[model samples]
Target: MVDRESDTYSCECAMFEHMGILCRHALKVMVHVGVCRIPSHYILKRWSRDARDVLPDHLKCYQKDSD
Candidate 1:
């Protein structure tokens, strides 16, 4: 189900809740509703291309390697 007011979505598949990934059903709903982009909250940092570029404040002391 898509809740426009809260910008939340749910599916009987429970893929997002279980795997932290948006399911095909949810994607279809988003497309049908004309949502051009996926919300930031749904994009896990670990899954992004720049995931390694960012570190928590507590781990900031560590530096990334050039190679």
Candidate 2:
């Protein structure tokens, strides 16, 4: 089963949390279930071509240092 929170989702596979990107398991479930769009928070703007664009308001200050 996939576990979902307000801004992120995970599966027992845990690859996204470990790698800072979507896991294969998550992508498979999304495609199989016809989830057409990724939740905004899950999109890493740094990976986008327009990486300089500011994160949306709800996601502001959402990132924290793991240390």
Candidate 3:
């Protein structure tokens, strides 16, 4: 059934783990629903290189002035 396939895809794509971003399965659903643009948040998250910057500035010991 289509519902089962969709559910499987959603699980496989890990959509439930990240609601803020669409997994590939969600994108497929969007295509089925005739959605375009795929939203900047999703695409941005996919292509973003900023994930490495999530650590706090203070966490970088080298960046602190030598005591």
Q: Please, what is the TM-score per model?
A: 0.73, 0.56, 0.36
| Candidate 1 residue runs with Cα over 4 Å from true position | 53-67
Q: On a 0 to 1 TM-score scale, where does candidate 1 land against the true structure?
A: 0.73
Expressed as tens digits, the lDDT of each residue in 1-67 for candidate 1 is 8889988889999998899999999999999999999988899987887786777767766656533
Superposed model 2: Cα runs more than 4 Å off:
3-8, 52-67
Better of 2 and 3 by TM-score: 2
Tens-digit lDDT string for candidate 2 (1-67): 6555453457886777776788887787778866789877677777785663466767655645212
lDDT of 3 by residue, 24-66 (tens): 6677776786666655444544346654455467775654333
Instruction: Return the candidate ranking by lDDT, descending.
Output: 1, 2, 3
Better of 1 and 2 by TM-score: 1
The worst-scoring run of ten residues by lDDT in candidate 1 lies at 58-67
Worst 10-residue lDDT window for candidate 3 reads 1-10
Best by TM-score: 1
* Model 1: per-residue Cα lDDT at residue 56: 78
Report how far off residue 26 is in candidate 3 (Å): 0.9
Backbone clashes in candidate 1 total 0
Clashing residue pairs in candidate 1 are none
Candidate 3 segments exceeding 4 Å error: 1-12, 15-22, 45-67
